[model samples]
Target: MSTILVTGGTGTLGVPLVERLRALGHEVRVLSRRSPTHPVDLREGTGLDAAMAGAEVVVHCASAPRGGDDVAAGHLIRAARRSGTVTNVVYVSIVGVDVVPLGYYRTKLAVERLLEGSGLGFTILRTTQFHDLLARVVGAAAKLPVVPLPSGVRVQPIAVEEVADRLAELAVPTPAGRVPDLGGPEVRTLAQWGRVYLAATGGRRRVVPLPLAGKAYAGFRRGGNLAPGRAVGRITFEEFLARRDRTGA
Candidate 1:
């Protein structure tokens, strides 16, 4: 029964989130710089107030996926403060925001800080790497005679849909602060995950283990981004591949 404003509505997370909210009987409006004309670029602070006019919840999911000018969550926090009508600001963050050694992760952590100090009802749901990304990694790694696996890397990847559902749930309620980390049901090594993907795709490839060095590689190899004992997703990686197979893409 709440009207929710979803930023980055055309992006990976935003598209599905808006659909879920609309399906659940909530009035949904998508904020973007291009389509739908609600033009609120969190990085620039434009069109935010207009989008927030009647929104009770704002799901801020408009971060750069890989490359950008690097605006932290603090920017959105300031925009929310200016809107002054948002009841809860639910932020979509990665599971290793606190443990990973990457620039994007650092930005996420800084944004979390901004949310904590913004004095508004807020929630942060930390999730693992998306399943689609796993497919990409697997496709790339399986190209060689033997898959070069990162030793000791433990990952529990979740479907994007599951993460979106969790965000939708958080959007409708009062901020629960930092919620439980959402992860896939089972954990797998980097090589095993890659193999599963290749096998599912009916591709011929051998799996080989590789010891990755450096801080970022070490962090990933040491299970820095997974949450095994926390929130478990319903979809399995194999099941996800099966679905993709049905679509024949």
Candidate 2:
């Protein structure tokens, strides 16, 4: 059994991925900015050697959220190449990173390029929007009486659990370089999902459609970011919302 290292192993998806890998009898090591069993900072390039020592597979799931610097992912890819000890490197990226001109997506695309050029065996999984994103949108919209949604476009979001599973599966296989895009079983408009989220949360917020302008908004409105034919997730939006801790309460 090869030891696999997971960057950001304590994160939302990382937690479950680690647990699953551990159950499969693989030695699991985690890298994070704080309190990691094996503390390593990709940005600072510190403590990486100790964490990577003896690891055969490295699943690169660590990333900064929106508004934070994502160059760290690129740094981690460089570090993995320096290690030369790890085998497969699985990098988790978002779908439409090429089409979405957002800073966060742009950073991810750069990291993907870095991995491809690194000469290390790597697999790239570009997944659709996460189910949790819908919940976040609902929560943000609840702050105002009127929730504004883009009137013209649609989204094909996937479950984070499914994304995690795909990452785990790729860790053991040879680098399938740029695997097929993973999306949810259904497609829905932002307003439609917003309403479902509000109903599931028992919220009374009103959702108003808005005409979003600008290139980023147009990309989203034109469905440039969505991969409808790549649908693979089993969980529906309603199923995801209903499974929440306080659903219907």
Leading candidate by TM-score = 2
Worst 10 residues of 1 by lDDT: 67-76
lDDT (10s digit) by residue, model 2, range 45-113: 778877877777888888776643356765666667778777688888888888877778888888888
Stretches of candidate 2 above 4 Å error?
Answer: 66-70, 246-249
Worst ten-residue run, lDDT, model 2? Answer: 66-75
lDDT of 2: 0.81
Which residue pairs in model 1 clash with each other?
Answer: none
- Clash pairs, candidate 2, are none
Question: With candidate 1 superimposed using the best TM-score fit, by how many Å does residue 150's alpha carbon deviate from the native?
Answer: 2.2
Q: What is the TM-score of each candidate against the true structure?
A: 0.92, 0.93
The lDDT for every candidate, in the order shown, is 0.81, 0.81
Compared to the true structure, candidate 1 yields what TM-score? Answer: 0.92
